[model samples]
Target chain A: MEQPEELIPKKEVLRLTGISYGQLYRWKRLGLIPEAWFIRRSTFTGQETFFPREKILKRIADILRLKDEYPLEELVRLLSPEVVPTEVAHLDPLALAPIGPEGRELLWKSGEYAFSELVALACGAEAIRRGAKPGEARLLVEVVRRAEEALRAPTDLSALLAEKTVEREGLLLRAPLALVGREPLLLDPECRIKVRLDLEKVVEGVKLALGGEGRG
Target chain B: MGERNVTISGAGRIEGGSYGTVKIAGSGRVVGDLVAEEFKAAGSAKVEGNLKAQRFEAAGAFRCEGNLELEEGEAAGSLKVVGRVRAKELKLAGSAQAKGITGGYLRAGGSLSVEENVEVEIFRLMGAFEIGGLLSADRVEVELEGRARAREIGGEKIVVRAGQRSLGGFLSQALGFLFGQGSHKELVAEVIEGDEIELEATQARLVRGGKIKIGPGCRIERVEYTETLEVAPGAVVKEEVKG
Candidate 1:
């Protein structure tokens, strides 16, 4: 199908990109998403931004590809074309071509792979930001494993890894128990703990909050 | 006290006395015992005797000219003493790196790294404890590693690389180790929330969201809800014992 030249509405853009309206607005403000690609409304209060169909789709594809390693600013720097004034007569009219069909297909497949990896990476980054060592990422493994187990077996789901005493014999990693009743663990946005479980019963206990998958 | 900030400097002694919140700067030295609500010392301060405070912060170059002590109403925010600290209870929130002997109980909410030569005469924990230095205690309890000196002595768990002539504690009670060594009984949790906590070597329960590697010669009690948990062959983890 021949793509339209005008910018797509917010709902359509969000449907294509799987991003929220708030995220898109923030990205635009941060220059992660190009302002040139957006069509602004003529009015003030009712003003809304629209994404050009091709440009928005391309940006979505690029965002999916680079979400793992690159931040929004870096992605913009790499993908956005250099702007030249129309008054310059000797400027090159050369425009960067969109990723080809084969490339786009590869990117679609790569999106799935990137999604899972980005989830794990995002979790890791959050942990480190909280002053945890990189090696502490294993905490998520147990979380994911319990989530998987819960999906596989439809039991109580909150009694999987109960807190049990284990001797520190020949063990390499000791579990930190400083998060009993503090911050609500955000297992994605919807799932959050209202009450904390016992520290000892946490292991093998399965009140896990799964992210993106296994929520059903 | 009404939040009075007192500064001690230049080879001074307060004998056996008390204050509100002390802010020691500029090569200050205290020879006698001190009791205060809060104490902060920086720039080559030396405390010759015991110190008891509600909150203690020692930065820059500090020396425990004598024994160090703290009480339930006292604590240390960040303690870095090159010399020995012999107290009944030592609680720290920030990083603590002490070389001298810790005669009494030691507790911290943050990371604890000790030099190879220093010995923790008594190691106790209300939080996590990380020891890169020598630890010699009757009993030890920490969320992370117990004592990781280059050559660790007897306690409960001794897990570190490149160590010889090390004596590990054998089991007499449940879980292969006794729990009564002037140390409280506490388990590591995946997440803890408070003003502070200490990380221990043996029971470093972590709330992980990403990849983690339990290093060689280390021990893990439990790992709750994380992305990945990779263990080296030398690492050991005991099964969880449910109540």
Candidate 2:
């Protein structure tokens, strides 16, 4: 792709922003602007950095506007992708993508549900449709939700559900947990249930499945 | 009261204390020193005092005014630390500016600018780095795409090579020339010392190693090797010594 004329050099960015190099780097560290936005290019003199002109100008303006109202730490969260606790009952069922009507209904029936919980419920609904028992599927969803909560990040239901097996009292359940990198953790010692799921994979999956829903 | 997890989802400030996991999803500030098993910040965060954690990860902007001690540190946004940093693994996919860093493994895919010394067991850079002080590592590998500089480097095994410029790079350079874009593609260092060393597209003052291989686009003031040495076609060495 051809270079856009809107790319402003680092020196120019500083001059226009009326900020020093120290302030620029400090803001970058504080997450006022993303590091990827700092574009490096080979110059006649040496390697110099550049930034998208309008984007940088606007970002700096926003930072200045909110600097006093919120501390730097709080500003980072305000500027980042919002993680709102969503209630399934409050949302329109038709707007959820990839999830079928049955799955939507199942999620709506559940009380308050976070976005990750909704994804987990969808996975459970899919498993039940695939001939798994209803009770076992519900257990799977609960387990996936717990795992997501433990990870403290959005969890992927598809990948987590791919190899998950629900074991019943003294009987071999459906599918055994696929422990890729980590060891097995005894979630319920009395129930003799052990579940191993790749936390990183689950997080990545949730990000992919949810698309833009959880980003904001 | 001890909390298992503490999450700040809005604009909030946390007085430094001990916690199992500290997560900041929105803008937050830490007033005093903090101790946590895991510290994760996705939004902007600032720590006024020191921080000790097993794992410290930030995807957005983070700034630590005091010292930071972490077993594993990962940053995808920008991180600025005014005090010393000690970590087992430090991974950067964004930009990091630190006063001094001591780690076991340092991997960077973005830019790193350190004002003081950097000592690591392994140092790998796929992006750009500038170190004002001495850099000592057991293993050092660098594929330079942007630019890299260090006052001095000491390692057991060291390899430095130029990264391939993408098609976008060529286009930008062409446009840059016409539109006044700066184009500098070279690695600069004062001195390099290692047991085994390989260099390409680097400009340095002195290099001393047991076994040395100088590849293309290398300009060196002096080279001293104990065992073996190989010089490529496009390398320029002002002085060479064998012992």
- In terms of lDDT, model 2 sits at 0.68
Per-residue lDDT of B124-165 in model 2, one digit per residue for the tens? Answer: 986678899767777789877667889777667889988664
TM-score of chain B of 1: 0.40
* Separate clash counts for every candidate: 71, 22
User: For candidate 2 chain A, which ten residues in a row score worst on lDDT?
Assistant: A178-187
- Candidates' lDDT values, in order? 0.41, 0.68
In angstroms, the error of model 2 at A144 is: 64
Candidate 1: stretches off by over 4 Å: A1-216, B1-66, B71-77, B116-134, B145-150, B156-243
Best by TM-score: 2
Candidate 1 lDDT over residue span B1-243, tens digit each: 455557767545444467787777667766677778877776666676776666666755555644465543223444565555555566565446665545445555444556543334345443334344334453344442223222223332222222121335432121122223333322332222111121223334331212344555445554322234556677665532211
